[model samples]
Target: MPETVFEVDVDEDPEDQPDPIVNRWHPDTPPAATIKPGEKVRIECLDWTGGQVNNDDSANDIRDMELSPNHHLSGPFEVKGAEPGDMLVVDILDLGPFPDHEWGFTGIFDLENGGGFLTDHFPEARKTIWELDGVMTHSRHIDDVRFPGCAHPGIIGTAPSHELLEAWNEREQALIDRGPDAQTGVNHETGDDEPPLALPPEPENVLLGDMDDDKLEDAAKEAARTIPPRENAGNCDIKNLGRGSRVYLPVFVEGANFITGDLHFSQGDGEITFCGAIEMAGYIDLKVDIIKNGVEKMGTDHAMFKPGYQDPDFSDYLVFEGYSVDEDGTQHYKNGNVGMRRACLDAIDYLTNFGYTREQGYFLLSTVPIESRLAGVVDLPNTCVTVSVPNEAFDINIDPDTLADDSVVTDRSDVAKPS
Candidate 1:
């Protein structure tokens, strides 16, 4: 076992833990631990929400989640010779859920909260809990499916420089000030016609690990939230970034203050639900190396990574395709977002034929290892997207040739909903 530089008690609130677990991103936040380049290390992380959601039968936690304090990251672990303009190379060696916490969850936030990609179609709060048995996972909330997980860290990145952080704040705030986008659906809380355009810095519930008291007040006000992926790759949520993957992150501040959290047992492409993936509290084993001036060598300003070699293989799939057409048949020009939503909706509709509710189908899609591909984009009038589910995921035959019927899943059950 590699030495664990930073650890956490899963049973305790993240804010109350002995080591400071920060929610916001700031270059000034002190490093909680340090590691030398080329040395192997282990780091434990809280789930993105810091265990606020529980292993229960209700979805109230998803509905009423406090979104401000989130993505509780483990460290800004300084690398011994790291400096600005270098690329911090992170190799994800191994990772898994805590032995006592071998279970994980996936949820859909209500529209008033963050809401998901398909929130307008399925606007209520829902949840599914999966029991992890080695690499395979099965859920009680959604029936008739079992699949191997692509276990990996969902969020990881280096701290941003002050100039870059301010650029993020300014552009994102400008979008927020313009109000919600008309094409993005509605924000139920504000009664706006669109969901939130962007999340800005909020001082409430800010946790800066081991920083001085006087600087805490000022830092919290300007610190960037960890919801969206920026140049530093804060929360990209790429599922294939598992064991054996190598990430090259641009070092903005001295020491390459790398922080990470939001581990997932498995997630389909897109993580359609805002709270998608089988979220878990877990540990990641890593090895670091600094490519001195690698940022200039690569000629890329943003983070880059090689996909992990050991992803599960599923040869057979039932692929559903969608075009650049809205649900209401409104025509749009090369809108890939609209096309992808239609593709996901089509998959949910197909699952209903096997006696699963639309909600169950949506929940299942989020946790499974499905492939979502952008099949076409360059053609002028319409863009194409496809969502393909592995045929082997279900016990019964669901291939197109078999012509699936409701006989497979007779004893249908639904996911837990809010009271």
Candidate 2:
């Protein structure tokens, strides 16, 4: 039987530690933070955006809220003996079910007033409401049926560039000084009025919510004084990262730089909106292992990953492609390949190694499977790409959501084209 070792319902007091930010909601109050190879577990987590917005809450509530940079990652707990380059194998022991009222979620965006996406469509910061009950919907809207709410999160990854904030400030101020960003507009350089802005900085700031003018003014400087995550690893509240899933990350600095916090109970494939599913407070068990230089793709099975809070029946993988430009209007691809077939083939050969008899693999993959993705634009010569595969296709099981990822599953030099 799977062991439920990470559940914490006792609800510890918020003032138990210093840097109160870490204690925003709850820490690893649950005793055991590491599970044995075959043990099943459950973790307690608060909403990804803190208490900014919840189920009973409204879009208006989220619009007028102030959240802190308390990424919900459970622990930097060092895996017994994991070193650099060694893959930390995490198995999804068991996924615990929770009620809809228990979890909350939402997406984060800036407005024209504060530099958000598509400034034209949204003049201000806003989050769309999505469900996480794990239902289904019609294909062409031909039927009135709704899809189940498989609430999960969209941004679960390992802590790689934790030191980036310290190193990348030359242009940080330039962005803030520019005031709010344009969601959609002409990039004078490209002469295209419809291009999207590059990825925004991870700098943290306080949103002027319903607080009194005095309170707002008081919190303004201090909040603004707070530098958003420079590693640019902030604001990822993917739901599939909670219980199981071993996220592989490149080690930029010491300690493998592992940080995670955003939690969701259940989430859909394309979390089109912002936050929902089970964004609640639960316990998290983190195990850290190291991988030698260079963090690469995940396991042999799947799109390298699966969401933490999804159902076994949900077919499809999720991956993302980031877009960006330069002062000279130069564009860069996430990797060097823009070919869909190449990307698809990359995913294919990977799954094939996981034990699929060529025929079954193709049929099953086409039937109900797809890739999960993470979106990133803006940077330099490169962007971010996150691809997710369902657990059904893969032969390996691990927690990329909570545990530290310092493993490199495959060598990049040997990615797609067979040697």
Candidate 3:
């Protein structure tokens, strides 16, 4: 086993851990540990919500979930000799759920909290608890579903410089200032007066690892929320970044205060639900090395990574296609977001033919290892997208060529929703 540089007790509150975990992104967030360039270290992490949601049958926790203390991160581990303009190379050696805690959760946040991709259609909170057996996952809330896990950390990044952080604040706050009336050109799923265009720095419920009480207040006011992926690679939610993946993240601060958390046991392409993925408390084995001045060498300012080669191979798929047209028949030109949302909805509709409720189908699609692609963007006014589900995920035959009767899945259970 590699040296365990940072260990988190799964039972302890993430904010009050021994090394402490942070939610907001700021350069000043103290590092829990410092690692040499060539050292391999094992780091433990809490789920994104810090145990706010539960394993039982209830969606109330999700409906009333507090947004501030989310994506609870594990470390801001400083890499010795890492400097600005360099690239911090991270090797995700391995990852998995902690012992005796093999289960994980996926949720659809209520519209009021931070609605999902299809919040307009399904405007309520729902939950699905997936039981992990070896590398496969099966949900107790849904029927006839079992698929291999593609476990990976959902968020990982280096610290931002003061200038970059300021830029993030100004740009996001400007979007928030635009108010809901302004459509921002893209037909996003902000369904009927939804959450802000961009979440700003919130002082309430902020936790910066090991920072002094005196400076905490000022830092909290400027720290960025961990909701969206920024230039530092924060919260990208890319599903292919599993074991053996190599990420080249651009460094902006000295020592490269790197942080990572939000581990997903498995996730589909988009993580369409805002609180999507089979989220779990887990550990990751990583080896770090500094690529001195590699950002200039690569001619890119953003983080780049090579995905792991161990992704499960599925021989067959059931494909659904969608164009850039809303469900209400409103047309839009070259709207990939709308196109992808339509594709996902088309997939959910097909799943309902198997006797699953719309809510259950939506929840299942978020966690499965499905493929979503922007198949056509340059063709015309209607960009086409596809959502493809692996036929092997279901026990019953779902292939259109040899699919069973509509009553194939007779006994269906709905997802856990609030009363």
Best prediction by lDDT: 1
RMSD, model 1, all Cα superposed?
A: 2.5
Give the C-alpha miss distance for residue 186 in model 1, angstroms. 8.6
| Candidate 3 regions with alpha-carbon error over 4 angstroms | 181-192, 402-407
lDDT of 2 by residue, 1-419 (tens): 33333333223332221112221111111212343332333444444444455444234554555534433333332233433444444433333324534333343333422322223332334332333343331111011112333333333333333234333433555653444336545554565544232223333443322235565444343222221322223344344454456554443433332333445444433332233233444334443344443234433211134445445464544343333333234564554333222333344455444333222222222222244443444555665544455553332432234124444232211101101
Give per-model TM-scores.
Answer: 0.96, 0.46, 0.96
Backbone Cα, N, C clashes tallied per candidate:
0, 90, 0
Report the CA-based lDDT of candidate 3 relative to the real structure: 0.88
Name the better of 1 and 3 by lDDT: 1
- Look at candidate 3 and give me any clashing residue pairs: none
Q: Listing every candidate in turn, what is its Cα RMSD in Å to the true structure after a full C-alpha superposition? A: 2.5, 15.2, 2.7
Better of 1 and 2 by lDDT: 1
Clash pairs for candidate 1: none
Model 3 residue 315 lDDT score: 78
